[model samples]
Target: MTKQGAGQAGVGQRWTAPQRWTLAAAVLGSGMAFIDGTVVNVALSALQRDFGADVGSAQWVINGYTLMLAALILTGGALGDLYGRRRVFGLGVLIFAAASGLCGLAPTLGTLIAARVLQGIGGALLIPGSLAMIDAVFGDALRGRAVGLWSAATSVVTVLGPVLGGVLIDLGSWRWVFLINLPLALLVLWCLRGVPETRAAGEGARRPDLPGAVLATAGLGALTYGLIQAGERGLGGSSLLIAGLGVAGLAAFVLWEARAPHPMLPLGLFRSAGFAGTNALTFLLYGALGAALFFLPLNLIGVQGYSGTAAGTALLPMSLLLAGLSGVFGSLADRTGPRPLLTVGPILAGVGLAWLGFLGVGRPYLTGVLPGVLVLGLGMAITVAPLTSAVLGSVSADYAGTASGVNNAVSRAAGLLAVALFTLLMLGSFRGSLSAQLAGTSLPLTARAQMLGQSGRLAQVPVPDGLSDAQAAEGRQAVRLAFADGFRQVCLWCGMLAALGGLVGFLSLRGAGRGRQGGGAGENLHEPRGEEIRAGQAAPGRR
Candidate 1:
């Protein structure tokens, strides 16, 4: 077949049986990855209780997957272009399901974290190929519509994930959350038989940037460890030593990417002011979002006296707005350009967070948090679609796949780092508040030491062993007050992050005209389909 014919062959054709099956498989696989991303957050308190875990370990459970996903996802995209997209996508599913099974069976905190790391690795591979597989099978005319359907379908899973996880926790146990993936994985594999195998035309024996992947992972892992440790051991602890090494590793990775022939990430894209600023804004905003999502459940279930399901459903307003309004906002950005939405969205988000920070202890959800949730939801809805447009617009059409991968990776990294760093803020504030609150009370020394040891529990610290019934009641009140104070401070810090994100976009992305903008490929949060990734596949291969 001629090149032009190959390009046009599937365009406007009836969706063949295989094509339908292929799209279904890819959508389900990506949904699995997406659902896992949000579902795990709601299950965190349950994990802590089951594992008898400390705060740092709990953070690691989340970060382990995120760190691998952020660091290695680009490699996954590159691999799809080189190896067959269908083959790699299937491998990723197998790995992810197996990892999920391992997670269900994990007997200890260490084991659970290890399983999650493996799961992250699988996600990195499958998430990129999930879209890329559809790109390979569909013709150019149909690819965009196919991807839109895929995105919409996946977004529904994001909304359902937390609620489903909550039901699993309440109905059975947290282990079921991991175990549930097995059937989904099986269905994906069954659908795979209809998928066409395709790879980008490339040079003979092209190699992946394995070293770059290693360096990035090492750096992020080390730095995250240090941040979590900093909360426990202070800056003087040995965790700082590891963190310093992480800094060095990252610095070295940057230098390597600049020179490598098969660079996993092309650094030159940062030269575009809009590109750099969009990404910077992504980092800041996602960091704040991650902190809020990670901790809100802890506050609701553990401190605010909500049920697991209640805590899970609390963010319905935000998630639903994001799903329902994203396309509308995307069209608006298309008409108005990204500057206004980008600038206004973060500010709204910041204001909402500040309102949440001021919530008094044990207030009702409807009055205390719902309005702030709505405002934050509106902010995210307005920003996300425009943000995607800005990122794609910032780069040349040629780099859409690479740019999208990097942006997605950055958002995940932001969340990973936020959870680590914010955990520190929570600890510092909690300890200080506890110290002051207990100073005037006659709590026994053992009681104080016990509270200190449970620092990782945040608002959920268990009752101390030796207190009298009357003293226990008093101690409970003191712990709750201290935790509440700390939570307020954490919320305030999130507000600062969102505000700073807004500032970054305002200064860097705004151009000469009001709400006017140039254009590029329309890259959304999901991996771009078609030639954006395929375009680069022809290189590194001998004719």
Candidate 2:
């Protein structure tokens, strides 16, 4: 069947009891992955306390999963295309469940990090395969609505992650956060049996692009490691070397993609202005989003003295706003073109971040933080759906799975880099400010030295009692001032990133052009010949 016809037919299928159950399972699995992405931040301190590790060491819990997810998401999509989507989806559920169990049982920080990496691999497989399955099964009329529903549903779960994690940690222990995934996974697996398998187009001859995969993985991995190390080691010596090599390797991967007969990422897609703009915007916008998400919780708990649940609760308003508005934005994009929304969204987000930058210590949450979070949430809602539509709409049906995979990978990579870079900036500013403050203090030289030595843990350090009340009060004020300064600097950087993204998006978008109505650019691209298909197609196997 033609791609359009297939979509229409798929949607036309009655929502039978079995089909409904299957769809529910897919949504839960996909939502769990996205939710877990942001949920663990609130528990970082708890993890550190339980495991007797420093913040830097504890970060591996997040980095391990993010790195694996960012590196392998595109490959996951390709694997889904090679294997039966249903089969891969099932395997992903199994893998995710098993990994979650391992994480819950982990006795040390190292074991937890390892399990997180494995969980991420399963997540990489599940997200794209589930989406592709929805596309292959749903009809055209329902496709947009289904995608919107799926997006909305997952977003709700993402927003809830913090609250759920907080409750689990408060009521029980941090381990419950990981354990919660088990029952959800089991339910999904049970529902999976009813989803029909879609046959792979090139089942017999398809093989992975191993060289391209290796280069891309190594490039991102090295770059992230370098950024993380920069906070403590500075950008000299080994850091610079690793960073440079990463850039070079990434450049080589791009070059290789252009010439590879069956490239891992088809370079031709960049010919579409909409596609390029959307992907670039995705990278920048998401990078900013990730940075803000990572830092905001730290600021709330470390500087503001909020509990884990309270910090997570602070995020609820923004998350709720986003969940409500994203579907509206998607429908709007369908009716009007994506250009205006794309341009406006990032600009508003930039303004929000810039506003937050001005907030100092002792500022009330309602007066300072709420407005910024609200505005940023609205902007995110406006941008995300349209961006997804643009990328998927720019490619052909056969390559839909690939395009989705690439966009997802880029988004995750943006998040990974954002976390590393922003953490470095925040920590660097905090250290510099604290050091300067300590140097000029008139208190005993020993006290000043102690403060400087413990600067990284200033939030946790008790006010020293050797001095008068005035002196102790001054010391506390100094620490808060340093943290405020660092937080403001990071927010300013986020603002700059968002504004730059806006400009790039405005310039690159094609407006309401010939292909904007939505069958996509696939029909215009040349189809593979019989012999070419036999050689280039991916084989059917578990992702």
Candidate 3:
């Protein structure tokens, strides 16, 4: 090699070493949050069995974490800006790892729920700071590429969460699901040492809105608890009271944020019609996505007789579309605009879900499920990147962080609300259908009681005992049909909501893409950050 060539090679090695560590820390840190989110879902049924928890507790195990996450994430971002980004980020890692250990060791459902809530608090700190750290370290020229690299690596792990969880659950107990985070967390902490601390320079007086965080968390908690209780107890005394408190708490939170000098969620961001509309569309689309995902595994494993691992792997095609095709769609939206892609994507998603609703009691996976899965995957791939572009693009740089924070909150709330509301409807439908079906059919009184007790569980409801082979077969058929009927109803709702989201996007947004129209920015905003923000559009429950 020439002397100049050797010099260039040495220079390349120097630059490559730090960059590799930074990207590694970011990818693993954010991916830890991502993987944990989906892996827990795979363990939900196991949690139910292990803790003797009812379906409502299972919902709480997931929603409790998500609730804390959505409500506190904006505050978390602010905390990082005020405190050192790397310091807060490191603290988040330690907290998350410790919480994971607690979750793994939890002896009861209540204990597990508490641990999950702690995990969410840790996640709120880790998520925003992880990306912000990359922004702080990399110069403007290289920032976009660094963020893109981070998104690509993390997204792969997010998609693999269920598959990994399934393998762990099959090989061992559900405890391993939470335990799996330990090694990953340790890796993140080790890489983070090289990441320099960064913080907002001028805003030393800014204190995080602690009151806003408290109210939002409390309000969402009450709402979720009330909704879950209503499934078992109807609109009774406790449910009504708790739900009322939830409404009041949220109302106060809104009122407080509007008036607070340093607000966690700035109300003024909603002043932009384009931004507001895009988020409205996001809520609807993500809600539908959440419903489909929450129930898909149950349909596969509980009703269709697939194993946990097989059921988990079934979603691979959809995840691949999200992970692989998102970058392609990101490019397409650059030439076009977000509007057309956003409008078309949700419509396709609705049709795919509509196809899913038609899946019979026990149909073949290829014919009955694969086609819809592939279609839904494509639809999601088309929308996510463009939708993210429109969201971040809609706001000015001054308000960009808070704006993205609000949009992120909306997506998480969409999932929590969808699961809570739809599960109620499914239960109501399931009970009525089961009662009517069994009333005329001739089930024994004991069998009737057994089915009624398990009605709220829907597909996960067990096959009852003491029945002969012929009777058990009939019982299983009846139960399957009931579950299918309820699931179909929910799927129909999902399809309709997704279509409505598409319609909203069509009317609210300009026909051209964010790159073309500029999202009120009056300048094009097309770049690699589009890949990162767009890919981040998916929540843990998205696929």
Candidate 4:
């Protein structure tokens, strides 16, 4: 394999055949991963009904996938840089497609959860590799525009996942949602034949940070498990103990990275203010986006009486806005710099989320949902391309895989934590509201106690047997309102997180631009001089 970007046909080229094929492969491979992330959310209700799962159990179906992706993405990035981007990316697509088949064939909730975890492992590898390939193949002059097109195309495909999943769930089965990945994976692998293989300067000599990978995996897994446990049983000695160990493991991983001979994640990358700020913004904004959206389908189907397809169709406006506007924003960032767009995008997204938090039952979709969804979509479109360009541009092309990996890791971790933490918050709000609503009814003591016991089921809690028509109707309405109350709190917190991301970007990313490479190769943490920048490809050893 040649050194990254060394005389490649696509390198420094504009819209050439090879460049177009490379971009297509990147988009399809990454789009497969992003689609799975949202499609599962639309399938959650059916999953719970079929499997007899409570809210806690259903959450595992999501967090299980995110857990492995958040933990292992850094190593996946390093592996791509060490081995070959195309090779690793193709392998990841194969693994993901196989895992998706397993997910669809799963007869038990445990089996489905296991398959999702495997799918996450595949996602960790391919997502960063796709972006790194783009960064490496395109010249500095064309990279931002290329990134924008990639962002726009992927965003459109990503949202389409839900609509597709909903149709499958309604007309066929939730199993079809997972099975659909098979054909997409085949297309990505086919595209990979034309894509070149590229690796860092000293690929064979550099060793992966195995110890760091283990610690990171252990830390994130423990924290996710502990948080899910707390949401089910409330804070307890065992949960706290596990969560404390998670913190210790993460601290150890950081310590190891600072001293490792060939760190998978070069800590020096964070020295750039633009790099640090973009990641911080990614964490807060992506976290809010993932966690809040997790609850939307549930609210619509379980509380607002929407069928799966109708609920999925309702979110189309957001998808359209992202597809239409992302490329324009990406090109704009190349000319004007990313700081202002980064600052404004998240704050606008936050306001949209806050508006959604006020929604209740019987509200019309046109008035209640479309406005907020449009605003949120617009904000995300503005944020996505600039954010990607800023992170990639912060480091030299040799470390593109690692830089993209780190940003993705932060985004996944944010979603993982937010889902767990917000589940806890939603449970508390649901319980309190359900109690108050039940108190106003003439239900018997024993029935009320039984209803409270099933509070973990949220809107799916059944009306007690032998109740009069009036009482049963009241009970069902009470369940809907209770679930709505909890959902509102989740959205409000999500709004705060998105707004705070904007603040972080404004403060930390001063003078950040698309063309500047802030730091390169861990040894040179400071910005490179003109001569050093020119020689970045010829560096002697890995960071």
Candidate 5:
């Protein structure tokens, strides 16, 4: 067949049974990567206990994966472009499956963390390749719908991850959580056989920018580690110094990208005003989302005395709401444009977080947590699809995969940074409050020192001998008050971040109805079907 005929045939082939199966396989494979991100949080305590690691140390299992995924995602996109999306994606699946097995078999905390890092690399590769494959196969009109379906599938997995993890942890073992990925990976591999390859426009010209990749990975990893350690050690310590080095490395990367003959990330992409703005909004909004995901379960189980299942189940309503509404917002973006939803979504999220901030100790779940969650979910549903559309539309088609990868990386980084910063702030505030209370009491200096030393676990701390019943009761109340204040403070910060993101969205994002036609040659390449437009097609307002 002639090239023209072949091209037409390929487009038509997308609707066939084989193509549908291929798409389904790709979506499921990619969804598992996203699901694992949220799933492990539910098993955090169990992992820590089993491995006999401190809370801070155990957190690295999650942090390591996310940090690597965020750092390497763009590189993964570049790899797909250089090689073939199908090849890279399949290899990623194999690696992920292997890593999951290793994780399940890990007998030491260090080994587990190492396995998680490997899993992240695989995840990074899988995500961009999967999306790129969709872009390669689907036509413009169907791309959005395909993306919506893919997003919905991943969203469901994300929402269910905690509940699933909770069940496994409570009834089975934490290892089951990691072990579960093995079977899923095998299923994806089997399904992948039906998927065909679609080469990009300039496939041969694409090469991995190794220097840029190295700099970005080192910088991001160092920065994340520093931020995580900042909570335990003061910001001015060695950790901060390392973080500064990481920043320097990232700056160097930016410089290299600017000068490189074939840059991994084209420096010129930021010339698009709408693209830059949308990315900025992504960073902050995702940060807030990450913070909420990280903290909410802890607060529910730790403070509210809810069971693991109850805490996970509590998130179900919010997850369902988000799943139902994201597609609606995607369609609305196709119609009325993304500006209104983008502006309104973040504001609503801010309001919800602010309300949550005011929750006192022992507050009712219905009045405090559930309402906030509901509002947050609605806000997320409204904004996420539009945000994605804006980013993809702003760029040219040739760079769509890279742009998506970058935005995904930024959002993940934001979450990582937010988790680190907020945990520090919350823990610091709680400790300070406890210290102040101890100082105010009639207790002797020795007693005060002892109390302050055990402030970290005040709620569960053993009552000391020779203390009157009144004193014990007073100490308990003070500890409770301190924890309540800390929780409120953290929520307040979340509100501020959400509000700021909303403002950015309002100011920076142009309506899809009012953007430039095409910025560059690379911009208008192959438009993916349904929600999967080329990066250039993601221009602010041009649906």
Candidate 6:
């Protein structure tokens, strides 16, 4: 293959065929990962039903992939820099396709989760390289525009993911969500030919921090397991022990990063208060956003009696609002700094979530759901661009890429933890509500016991057979109300977390400036990939 180094292309003023192909390759490759992140959420209800999985098991389907991706994405970026971006990207697509196929075919819940973990590993590699390739292929003058186009295209794909996944599940089966990725992966692989093989200059001596990556994966996995178990079974000694060990492992990772020669996360970045503060804010706000998105589909389909397609369509307005408003906020953040926007955005999002917590059964979508979704979307749109700018602006120009990548990782980590932790609240609320709702019914003591015991399954708890029609109808209503209450608890928690994120931004981002652009240290700071932000993920920040 004829390789091209960064800044070697002469077509700075116009889009050449190679540039067009490179952009196409990056968009398709990264878009595959983005689609999986969202589409799976829409399919969760069906997946759980098919496998007869509990809430914790269903959570694993999401956490398994997220755990690998969030933990190793930085290392994935490092691998590309050390090797060749195009090679690693191609390999990632292959791995993702293979994993997706396995996911579609897996017969057991455990097997499906295992396949998802592999998919996450593949995602870590391809996600970062998508933007890195554009940075390498396009000249300074065209890189921003190329990134803009890439972001716009990917955002549209992400916005449509839920709707498409809904249609697939409605028309066929949940397996189609994973199977669909196979064809997209094949397309990306074919497009890779147009993307030139590129690596950093004088990069042969550098190595990825494998030890740090391993520790991170272990620590997060343990913590997540402990949290999910605690949610289902309570804070038992075993769960507490596991959680303690997880904390210890994370402490060790920090210690290792502080001294390692080639650290995966440089500790020096935190020396800037803006960097620390903005990241804290990112963690809280994005965590809330992620949790809400994860559970809303379940609430719609399971509790509110929405069809998969209708439930998926329910979320479209919020995503569209996010996609539409990001640019306006990005430009605004440039002129006025990010502090005000960041603070207000999260608070508004918080309000939206709190409002949603009040939603009950039998309400129409337009009156009941759309209002909260709109507020949440507007707040996220306000926050996304400034959050990226805030992270980039907090560090010195030399650390721009690292800062952004760290923020991205933090947002993902936030989501990972939020889901597990809030599951505790949701389960607790569901059990209590189910008990109260069932107390008023004429069901037998045995039926009541069975329903209470299966509360962890939330709305999927099957009503016992051989009951009178009225009794069965009462059982169904009780299940719906109980599930709704649990969802309400989660939304309220998300609202508080988002509000806290705003407070962090206000206190921590007092004088943070906008990210600088052009030559020298700013060379690698391209526009943060909009698709990633709109998809509720952060852009990969690496040089």
Off by over 4 Å in 3: 1-18, 440-442, 511-543
lDDT of 1 by residue, 1-543 (tens): 774565476464688777798789988998887777777777888999887787778877788888888899889877877888888899999999999999999999899999999998998899888877787777665677788788777777767777888999999998998999999999999999988888877562256799999999998888889889898889765988988988898999999999999788789989888889988988888788778667777777777777777877887787787777877987988888888888988888887777777666788888988988888878877887788778777776667767777887788778788888888988899888877777656788788778767867776677787678887877776777787787788888888898889899889876723232344443333474211101100000000
Q: Write the per-residue lDDT of candidate 2 for residues 1-543, one digit (tens) a residue.
A: 777676777665666664565567768888677667767877776776677664455666787787777777666666766877788878888888899899989999999999988998887778667676776665554555566566556656766778888888788988998889999988888888777776447542255566777788788878877877776578888887887888888898899888886677888877777677778887887777667666666667767767788877876776676667766887898787777788888888788877777667767889878898777767766776676666676666656656666766777778777877777887788878876765566566777666666654534434566987777777776677777788788888888888788887778875644343335444211111110001100000000
Q: What's the distance in Å from true for residue 2, model 4?
A: 23
lDDT per model vs. reference = 0.78, 0.70, 0.76, 0.77, 0.70, 0.83
TM-score versus the correct structure, for each prediction? 0.92, 0.86, 0.92, 0.86, 0.85, 0.95
Q: Model 1, stretches more than 4 Å misplaced?
A: 1-13, 203-206, 440-442, 512-543
Off by over 4 Å in 6: 1-12, 203-205, 515-530, 533-543
Which regions in candidate 4 have their CA more than 4 angstroms from the true location? 1-25, 131-153, 187-198, 203-205, 393-401, 511-543
Error of 6 at 415 (Å): 0.2
Q: How accurate is candidate 3 locally (lDDT)?
A: 0.76
* Model 3: how far residue 329 lies from native, Å: 1.7
Superposed by TM-score, candidate 3 places the C-alpha of residue 288 at a distance from the truth, in angstroms, of 1.3
lDDT of 6 by residue, 222-337 (tens): 99899888987789888888988888989999999999998989998898898899889988887787787777878899988888899878878877888888889989999999
TM-score computed on alpha carbons, candidate 2: 0.86
How many clashes in each candidate?
6, 6, 3, 0, 28, 0
Predicted structure 4: lDDT: 0.77
Worst 10 residues of 4 by lDDT: 534-543
User: Cα-based RMSD of the predictions, in order?
Assistant: 5.8, 6.7, 4.2, 7.0, 5.4, 3.9
Ranked by lDDT, the better of candidates 3 and 5 is: 3
> Which portions of model 5 miss their true places by more than 4 Å?
1-17, 137-148, 201-205, 437-481, 510-543
- Candidate 5: tens digits of C-alpha lDDT, residues 1-543: 765565556554447655576578777887677667777766665675576554457667878787777677777777877778888888899989999999999989999999999998998788777767776776654555566567656656666766887888778888988999998999998888888865556654377788987898888777777876776677888888988988998999999999987777787878877778888887777776676566566566655667777766776766676667777887888787677878898778777777766666678888988898788768777877777677777776556655665676677777777776777776688789878876666666766676666654423333456777887766666666676677778888888788788888888775445333245333222222212111100000000
Q: Name the weakest run of 10 consecutive residues (lDDT summed) in model 3.
A: 524-533
Predicted structure with the largest TM-score when compared to the true one: 6
